[model samples]
Target: MKNLGRVTPATALVLESLLSADSVWGLQIVKDTGKKPGTVYPILERLEAAGWVQGEWETSEERKGPRRRYYRLLADARPLARDFVRAQRSKASSAVRPTPAFNEGGWSAV
Candidate 1:
């Protein structure tokens, strides 16, 4: 798999969603991540381009809507994706600062 460059929070969410299942369609991913279609599709494309994901158009004709592109996290790239997710989570947690308690009189830094 090639280098994925920058892994944004949106990309991390997409990776987490993909990790939850064997394969997922684009719309499902959008819904799962609660991210806009514009945000999710490009990430999927990037993942596919980076060789971390493989996307195949659904062949079954039983469904009534447009053909869905299902994306799967390539087995070889799973470890890398997981490590990225973990690192993003670690950064997010560490970057969070506790909010100061609210005061009825006025706002205080402490």
Candidate 2:
């Protein structure tokens, strides 16, 4: 819609998805958006490099879960959400199936 610069629509979906949730792993994002991880991970890396998102290893002992990298939108990108909402409220574009990239039938959620 607007000048997304180097960031593509896939990147936006990733950011928006994280903004909607607390934090999510690289693969879960793929599942949620039905996009290939090959495409999704790079976007995540770019987002992290741009400081728009942050990823960290998560450790949990309750279920003995392995370390997982979780991503969340940075503080700076938080304001953009409101602006996006305001813009979406007015303009109508339903064909925009702006989901993240992932291999739909290739992987199972772990």
Candidate achieving the largest lDDT: 1
On residues 1-110, what C-alpha lDDT tens digit does candidate 2 reach at each position? 12335445566566667777878887899887677999889888876776777899877757565767899877777777546544554344664546554476764433
Task: Give every collision pair in model 2.
Answer: 35-101, 35-102, 36-101, 36-102, 36-103
Point out where model 1 deviates above 4 Å: 101-110
Superpose all Cα atoms of candidate 2 onto the true structure and report the RMSD in Å to 1 decimal. Answer: 12.7
Q: Which ten residues in a row have the lowest lDDT in candidate 2?
A: 1-10
lDDT of 1: 0.93
User: Model 2: what TM-score?
Assistant: 0.64
> lDDT (CA) for every model shown?
0.93, 0.70
lDDT for model 2: 0.70
Q: What's the distance in Å from true for residue 64, model 2? A: 5.3
The residue-level lDDT of candidate 1 at 96 comes to 90
